[model samples]
Target: MAALRDAVGRYGIWSAELHTVSPGERGEAAARLEALGYGAVWFGGSPGVEDAAPLVEGATGITVATGILSIWQHTPAEAGARFLELEAAHPGRFLLGIGASHAKLAAQYERPYSAMVEYLDGLDAAGVPASRVVLAALGPKMLRLSRDRAGGAHPYLVTPEHTAEARGILGEAPLLAPDLKVVLETDPGLARSAAREHFARYLELPNYTNNFLRIGFTEDDIAGGGSDRLVDAVYAWGDDARVRDRIDAFLAAGADHVALQIVRGGTPTGLPADEWRRLAAVLGL
Candidate 1:
């Protein structure tokens, strides 16, 4: 099948934590996200290669992607079999996202680039197409490797500045999808707190910390949950307009697609109507 490279609005589920939303809720969330004017559903987390079909089972036109499936957890052979099966059944709707997840977390995360390439070869051996996959790349080496190996790159917790750097490294035609967080509240404390809860877990991860440190963030800035400056730079908190401006920043920076992670209460909304309406208008679906 062909790649789903169409310009999907920069808003969808980061779903980096797919298990957070159950199988039943996955489809429901996809429909609601599309209804809310979001273009794609980027399902994430450590779901085994074959574990995500139910996540996008209910949606039709929307593209379902794994922001990242760990290569360590499931062999490429396994992922390929499942991916090909799903693509045959649903053609042009599934984008397989693979990642050399954090090294510390993997049993033996040595040689991430090599591991990822071998995994891709495994998928090739199993009949999965190169155009049907994406990589979770932060640095330039991985970015180049991604272009050579998969369809493009899907970066998480990255700023528009990072997006620009990535775009430069990737050049034209490679898909560049970045995930952005949004807080619709006007209260500073609440918004910051939300950013903290969602981001603190990532602070200790070497992949994230090292990437930020290389980007010029000070050690102080990399402190727990990220300093306010770091949080504000990475998370687009505040009113709808402010968040929209950040989205514009990313697009202007040359990102092909942006997956907006509406970080708020329970569901995507669970906040207020005005914020939703304003965002929908800005997104243009």
Candidate 2:
């Protein structure tokens, strides 16, 4: 956890569209994030580790992690090779975050727990140290595996309360970094609307909903694009102060680091540089 926290500081960016941005633009943004004192930049959209190499090269110090590279998409041997290549080039600047992903999203999804174990075994045989990898876990079994095998857990679309519960499961040592969605809007309606827009897709996925249910949300709370209460609980919205409070809450709840997925205005595309800059000032990062 110490190494994971050092690699990714108190806060970092989690943007799925980061890899889709133009190479020059991505490089500039990566460098800017490093300059802004962000500890890491999480590449999402189920990226292959190779996809993140350019961004890792663009930034000199900041850690570059795959928010999650789907296990179904890349075999452990392939992922291990990529990890070695990147580590050789950048040393400790990369973290390979892997997950079983959602059953609905992967055709080959089956016995996720066993599959992850097998994948880790492959990685182990290929010489990828456990310290260099993290798991995208949401439940007790997976979280336990995260503690026993990997460096820690990186749960997505979760709240501070969930962070606390996860901390209990992970104990005090494993890295407990969760992806938090944020909306930088002052108006309640606008903020919730933005949150709902971004959250609607996840609502259809049972993996996320089951996790939400495990954390106490009812089926109704998961219905109709999520309730206002659900939206508020899941997303940190409003001004910088409001967002800061939410970030602080997660840290207080025992999260080692918070990977913020900034939802500026309503769109979740391109680089939200201005929002990131504002958040940096607010967080004093």
Candidate 3:
């Protein structure tokens, strides 16, 4: 827990990438990113915790994490093996971010929380140290479970406010790391356009929609992409200083680490290499 806490204190700027760098180039990209000073990389999209190793190899020492791996789609044995392998390769630089994926979407979502607990129990029984992992939590129920069962929660698609709420729920100890979306372009309308278009898919997912509604977004705000207010709040855009300011907002609100996702293309929020370099420069890491 102390190591996890130390990680949070040190990993001030983490970069999030939905599209993984191809194997041929991933390692190189990661090395460059590490050389650039980004402390960690948050990866997503269903490869389970197994994805950590290859990407970790990409960067010499930067921490590589699954933004989340649905606990339903894989077993603890497999994840445990991969977890150990990566840990052997990089030690403290690999963090496994796991989740009880939404019941509406996961292949096996029965007793979601309980299933996750069971999964964790198996991991423990199989010898996967709990400190090496985190839960993708949002609401209080999961947040509390995250505190008790594993290291902490890695909440996605949330604002600084949610980080504050999660911090309160998890209390003073569990790590509270939240991901924030960003569009580096100076154009508000364009950045919001990219954000809204990219966010429409998640809006239909009841869990995220429900969370947004609870967070004060109107039905209109959730409809047809997203309202300007919703887009601006969720996606930190404008200048380097502005985005850094938003990161500060999350930190002040109690987030230990903020994963910054750069939205480059409208279709998949592509993060161009040059763009990543630019951000890395401004972040001073």
Candidate 4:
């Protein structure tokens, strides 16, 4: 866990867009991110284990991880085998972040806790070390599972308050890295609009909405593309200082690392290298 924490540092970049690009482009972008001093690059959007190959092959120093690979999509044997292959090549540069995923998104989603335990058993049988794996845990039960069975938890769409509660459940040993959305825009309307555009789909997933409710957000707060309070709490918008402070809040609340996913107003895809550079400067990375 200490090694994983050291490799990930305090800040990392998370992008679903990386999966859309060609392998070579992804590799180049990963190398650039390493150059920019990000400790890790998380491949989002339900990527497969092999999806991280190009990133692992490209960046010599930056840690590469699946921000989460759905357990329902890939069998444990396959995921464990692919993880071994990548580990053999890149050694310590790859981390397997797996999740039960959302019920609406996964047809096979049932008894998720049991399924995750079974999946871990299979991974264990297939020679995947528990220390190299992280769970996309949101609820208390799943968070506890992550603490006892895996290296740590990589929670998505969470607030600092949630982070603090998760940390209490996970204790002090396991890694607690949460995904945080960053909107570079300064205008309240523009920032919230972009945040809503990115966050709308997540509202439909009970897993996330339930977690929001658990963390003190009401149904009204989640309705209509999320209330301003909900948007502001979950996303870091406005000036560089404000963004930096928000990210720091997560760390202060017991998050070992914060995976920043930049949200732009126009298109949802693209590398957003310029925005990343600006963030790197502001973060003094």
Lowest summed-lDDT stretch of 10 residues in model 4?
A: 262-271
Go through the candidates in order and give each one's C-alpha lDDT. 0.78, 0.89, 0.77, 0.93
Per-candidate TM-score against the hidden true structure:
0.90, 0.97, 0.92, 0.99
Clashing residue pairs, backbone N/CA/C < 3 A, model 2: none
True lDDT of residue 253, candidate 4: 98
Candidate 1 segments exceeding 4 Å error: 1-3, 7-10, 16-18, 265-282
Tell me, by TM-score, which candidate is best: 4
Best by lDDT: 4
Q: lDDT tens string, model 3, 3-100?
A: 77665443433444535456546566667767777767777665666555666776666777787878877889888887888788777888888987
Q: Give candidate 2 regions above 4 Å deviation.
A: 265-269
Task: For residues 17-50, write the lDDT of model 1, one tens digit per residue.
Answer: 4566567766766666667776677766666645
Q: Is candidate 1 or candidate 4 better by lDDT?
A: 4
Which ten-residue region of model 3 has the weakest summed lDDT?
Answer: 9-18
In candidate 1, where is summed lDDT lowest over 10 consecutive residues?
265-274
Give model 3's clash tally: 3
